[model samples]
Target: MKWLEGFQKLSSVLFILTFQGANCQLAVFPIGPALVNALAGSNVTLAVSFRGAPDPVLTWFKGNLPVGTWTLNSSSPPDIADGSRDVLRIENNGSLTFKGVPKHFSGNYTVELTKSGLGQALVTFTLKIFESIQNVTLSTQPDFAQEGAERFTLQYTMLQGVVEQEIWYFNGGKLKNSTRYLIKGRSLVILEPTRTDKGSYSVLLMNPFSSVTTHRNVTVLYGPDEPIVEALPAQPFYKVGDSLVFSCQAEGFPKPTAEWVFMGQILSDFHQGVLNLTNVQTSQGGVYTCSVLNGLTEEKREKNVTLNVYGM
Candidate 1:
């Protein structure tokens, strides 16, 4: 009976050793990095390695959902493909390759290997797929702003990804936040814009992976200031049959138009900002008025000059 008990104890020790030997031979491990960082539309691979086994059957899962299944000795390919664009296949070494990975494929992935006579083995990996910015556009509500207005806004739109940083530039220089300029989220506000605020404005959006920029041209409409008239000779009196040249100028945003008035009638012969009088007579020597008009601001300014013609 004691010998029987001794034989039973030997059998139990042998069973334990055999079980540990099988566990050591069937150990499985991942071959590559546990974490993968990939860009959208790019390809990536996840690999695993194992020893011994009854020809393991590998299965890939995204989160808790099954992605594909493949048997090592089987002649068939992976049982699943995400879509026509997202091509997925299993290689001979039990590695999964994704061709043209999509943005939505960023998540946790798990691979499970099972053999007929061994315990299952699992390996997990974290995948991060970054989406790049495809396009950017900028626009304004009114396109044109009036000087001394309450406010004007510039808006921006991005094609992909969340914005990590946003910066604005005016006339190729960076814009600062002040009482006149305010930046709120993805919009830029101009408080009481003046003629000096007219220029090219751009907004740049940046993320962890990429950056994009969009630009728009802004115009501020103002008024025509007082007109200045200059005589060619800088003299108040000119002789008969003498040439007289007068120039008028004004300051405005859209560029003001100038007209000349002789006596009480608009001179049809005079155009632009210059008034030329040749062979001046006493009748043409009265008061000459230079009038400037700004169509956008609906403002008009005029300047008058007196000339007396004497007989030569």
Candidate 2:
């Protein structure tokens, strides 16, 4: 009876050792990238390698939900026929591939591998799908602005996934936030824009997958300012035989037109904002007026000057 009890214990130990050896025979390891970054409207593959006799059963799951199944049969090759969705495919090496990946496809995936004599092995992966920006557009709130305007807003819009970063540029140089410039969400505001603000502006929109840019040209319009009239000698007194030249200029957009006026008569001989006199006389010492006109703004400005000629 003692010998029989000992033999029974030995048999149980042998059986346990055989079971552990069979379980250790099957080995599985992930072969490809653990994180898959796929672009929208593209294809991606998640792969794995297995070593054991008699092909193992491969099952793919996404967030605890079964997505696909593959069973290797000796008679025929394994295919994606058992996939739950048409976009999913199971390759011969027990890899899962997705075609035409979309934004919603980004998530965690798990591959459950099982063999007849081995414990199940699980391989995990993280998938990220990114969409590129498209149909980008840039515009200003008021297309046209006058000098000393309160403010103006530039709006940017695009069609794409979430934007990770946004950069603004003016005339090929990066723009920084200043007291007069404010950057808001998808908009740029300029306080009291003047003629100096006229230039080409661009915005760069970027995501993890790709980046896009848009450009716009802005022009700030102003009116004709006070005209400046000056004499060639820069002094009010000149000799009778001395030549005198009077010039008029103003600061304005669209270039202000100037007309010279003496007393109540317009000087037709001096048309281009300049009046030249060969011989100065006491009779021409009266007040001379320079009138500037801005046709676009329909605004007029003028300046007056007095010249005194002395006999030599």
- TM-score winner: 2
Write model 1 residue lDDT over 179-208, tens digit each, in one string.
988999879999999988999999988766
Residue-level lDDT tens digits of model 2 in 1-312: 999999999999999999976666666677767988788889888888877656778778888988877775534544444443667877877788888877787889998878865768788999888788788899898877567889978898876665768898889988778987888899888889989889999999887788888999988878688888888877759887888889999988878899998988889867568888878787888788899988776789988998888887
What RMSD, rounded to one decimal, does every model reach? 8.4, 7.0
RMSD of 2: 7.0
- Model 2, residue 269: distance off in Å is 3.0
How far residue 31's Cα lies from its native spot in candidate 2, in Å, is: 11
Error of 2 at 42 (Å): 2.4
User: Could you tell me how far off, in angstroms, the CA of residue 200 lies in candidate 1 after the best superposition?
Assistant: 2.8
Model 2 vs. true fold: TM = 0.56
TM-score of every model? 0.55, 0.56
Clashing pairs in model 2, backbone N/Cα/C closer than 3 A: none
Minimum summed lDDT over a 10-residue window in model 2 is located at 74-83
C-alpha lDDT of residue 294 in model 2: 80
